[model samples]
Target chain A: MKARGGVDWMVVVSRLVFSGVFVWAGWGKLRDPLAFADSVAAFRMLPHPVFVSLVALGVPVLEWMTAVLLWVPRWHRAARWVMTGLFALFAVALSVAQVRGLEIDCGCFGSGEPTKWSVPLAWGRAVGLLGWAIWYGWRVRGRSADQ
Target chain B: MREGLREEGLRMAVMVAGSLVLGAVVNGVRSDSVPWEYEPKAQRMSRELARVGIKEGETREVAAGAIELGEFAGMVREKSVLVIDARAPLFYRMGHVAGAINLPREGFASFLERSGLLGKDKSRAVVVYCQSETCEDSRMVAESLRRVGFTSVRVFREGWRRWLESGEPVEKPS
Candidate 1:
């Protein structure tokens, strides 16, 4: 019983941390879509101007929604899933950019500040976040089952 | 399982739609709109170039303000234009266009201040180039010049590669 309670506490703590990170990151990107667009371009993903522009506009909103959803108990599970997908997507993009040896900013936190993209560091962070999301999913599922 | 998948898909769609609507609202209602939608088309080209790592050897189709190698050389020979090398100081020191001045991106502002190019006629043709076709450093430097009121700024797409290929005169750093 004690171990289960401890696990429940861990889940709640991780949820708060995840929600805070997404909110902060999303707010920064939303305020400076152009800078975020530049970072997207640096990733060289779509390479098409129109698509890149759409992504720059759309991504931050999704991030904001994910953060909001995490705070709502009924939608919390869905938020974890969304975050997992987002982290996985970021990890893949970072990996590709690193493999191609592109010297550009991560645009992770938006622009104006010089934050050069580092593949290793970004991947490590994304993977860590994904792990947290998974743990959140597992613990929340068990908690519900117990109820 | 089918029901779960359907629910998940619906949730994803709702999230995507919500984001789009919010973004559209912000864009439509604001006069101080984001630069992505409001900046000049020419200014946006720099964003496109910046995205791809602006490599060392690939030549892009010449855009309206892009200058090819031969034209760049002719302008240099005419001595009516300023050629700014956007490579690092070390690379500029190794070799550069015979009359080109080093204004590496890292130290561009200070160099611009010291060089007095800002006070020069803004209409004077300024050509910027870096290591190769893929190098975006030149584009960035040219945009910086444009922002400072230079009316005629162009990029030498082939940059150092074409300059060397044509055997144009180069000067070693003093």
Candidate 2:
């Protein structure tokens, strides 16, 4: 395959790091679905029934799939988009919870007491990840003919 | 070049669709009210315990929310029930449930054992209360009791503050 615009090394590094983090988080939740449910309930975003159901099943699958797709060469670009979208969703949810003064755990890492969201941290992570995705997409578009 | 762009667009569309579908399916399955396998039976037991004002091993039963000052005075005449205040040591020292032993949340585990309270005749009713309904310290202590084979464990959800506010009998800290 042709090299894409001299290879965006920063994008590559970000993808790997984010993918690893997702994998680690997903695996921990997979080990204890009930605990994750409790964490989700603490957020108070949805009804208990709906929240419990999602955390018990949907969360782990999404996390694992996103993590796996990140490393696969064929799925790299698509995975980056999906991961970026997911993180963006998370940032939005956290922002709303903070504004509402809902002291619930982020549920990003299973069950625990509710933690305060750091706005700066959330923005930094979101921007960095989304930037990598955009860079990778731009590179691929420019080098399409060679590939 | 046009062909390459078209292919890439198609690929992106497919990937997006796949992710959305997966998310929907997972959320759909989870939104159902089915109980998960990992949630311990202790949750149900706690609910039940809260409903009835009787401890796990004790024979005497008090009305739920009967921990008011007047009620505590009337209820404790026989010394059949043990009202355990499950607040922090500092809070307990300031004042607690009248005649209630101070079982601070942190010291409860060993206190139950060392104080000979754990295996004491199950007939002695144990009423565990904490700061209030939102405080989980009492529920946790009650759950611990059940796990240790204590038959009766009642959580006084109203906790010490309610008991004090009700103007029940209270002894100042010595």
Candidate 3:
């Protein structure tokens, strides 16, 4: 939370944190995509395989891209907004599936056996990440691109 | 502000398009890429069932009935319906819907007779469930029931997770 030379190291660290999370998240799914696709299919939201496959493939990639772009001070706003949108999407999906009484794996990072509490855990993670992205966006506001 | 918005929009769009292209190329080239189109398991199972015939040993897969929680709970209370646990033996032994018999998915392919579940009247109501929302064992087992002439086959689609999460009665073997 310190500032020096027109730069906020805290904000820089925050940016790194966001990027690190996406890198971790993306790495898990990138390692085994078919399993991730299966998790997406389990949600029963996509309804079509094409959509499911696109999401399965695209999501992890988007995550990685966000991770990298957030490092670019100039692109922080766009990257955080994208991250916000993605997390929001996850929150909505998890919420709907829970409402429908679907007991499913959130597949946020990768695939795993879903248990009774997995749904809420997934939803909470989505909401939490969404909040973080918003905060990050706000924290970096009005700062020069280089900082 | 407009210039900033434009830059933001452009960068975001580039990221989106980059993700799309990279995803497609990576997925297409990857040795273990997932299929672009997927058939829902239930539908796939049904197709396999049709390919074999109604009375095949593998059992017919059809969505006969997916009963609600209330109905399943009532059935559990009354012990009138034949409750089937479709998970593995380990999970079955752990805890299951009260009065549920362990009929794991692997057994479905072969245990049509030895399990003695087949001896029951075909018209007797049958309720099947497995691990959680993502698990498909219950559906597969339900299909086996249909193939074996179980007339009142009902699936607790929410399965074991919902039942347990709601504090429904459960059985743990001694």
Candidate 4:
């Protein structure tokens, strides 16, 4: 990330890096979505199987789509919005699970993730990601292509 | 300004909708794809009971000293908890939680006698599991363990189905 001749190269590089994060995250969950569904069930918020499956499948696909769309010049801003919305949703889910005193896998990356991060830590990570998306969105506002 | 905002909103909507449709498509193609929707054991059992015209609470209520899969897996991995299979010998022979002992619900007393578990330490953390939450055997066996002075008995209500689904270790005893 750097500044070069009236173009904020930092913004360009940051967007690229951010898109990779989405790809890695999406692929991790896509590897075993059933296990991901189990992680979704751990939340206990949506006890219905349809809701569980929807979230389990929807989240990763959105992430992958976000990753791909981020590179498209016209779709860049919209992808940022989608990424921001996803993180905001994640923050809410993680916060609720934390407040309910539920001890379960975060499922931010994938199911059966070995790290065992506390719910609070995972919540913090989601909020951090949310902040990044919002920041990028702010930087790119009003600028058309390559923003 | 308004026009640009409208276009962004439309594209965002497209991305989200595309994701939903694609999610189903991907699941349909994958060999290991979960059933379109998972039917939890308790829900399935209740539906079956309604189909048979049997009402709820027809049998004695068993206590739910339930342990979720994450905690149960940890206990199993750590080998700190004594895991017990509440199924019969047939299921036990096929596969079971690693290091778990079989104490069939039907022959609870007889197995208890043969296994000599009565003399074991009662204060240890013990987890009892069966094939599915649809069956009450694990809960009943857990209740029995509690009665026999097992102080820290827990029922892995999700049991073997969840354990297998979660990709936890399974042992087929030779």
TM-score of each: 0.59, 0.50, 0.62, 0.60
DockQ of each: 0.17, 0.08, 0.51, 0.39
Best by DockQ: 3
For candidate 2, give the lDDT of residue A18: 76
> Model 3: number of clashes?
1
Model 3 lDDT per residue over B1-174, tens place: 899899989989988888978998999998868777865545444444454344334433446588999989998898898998987677788999999888765534444455686567899989998876567668787876777578888888888889988999999988
User: What are the per-residue Cα lDDT tens digits for candidate 3 across A40-128?
Assistant: 89888875789988888888999999988777777777887898999899999999989988777788888667877889998988898
Residue-by-residue lDDT tens digits, candidate 4, B43-162? 433443444344453223266678999999998899999999988687899999999999866546667767777789989999999877655668767766766678998999887888
Candidate 4 CA-lDDT value: 0.78
DockQ of 1: 0.17
Instruction: Order the candidates by DockQ, highest first.
Output: 3, 4, 1, 2
Top candidate by lDDT: 3
Candidate 4 CAPRI grade: acceptable
Give the residue spans of candidate 3 off by over 4 A: A144-146, B42-134, B137-174
RMSD of 3: 7.3
**lDDT of model 1 at position B139:** 77
Per-residue CA lDDT of candidate 4, range A12-106, in tens? Answer: 77777777888888888998786677778878889678888888778899999998888788788898888889889989999999888876777
Specify the highest-TM-score model's number. Answer: 3
Q: Of the candidates numbered 2 and 3, which has the greater lDDT value?
A: 3
Model 3 alpha-carbon miss at residue B150, Å: 18
Model 1 agreement with the true structure over B108-163: per-residue lDDT tens digits: 56677777886789999989988876657787778767666788989997888779
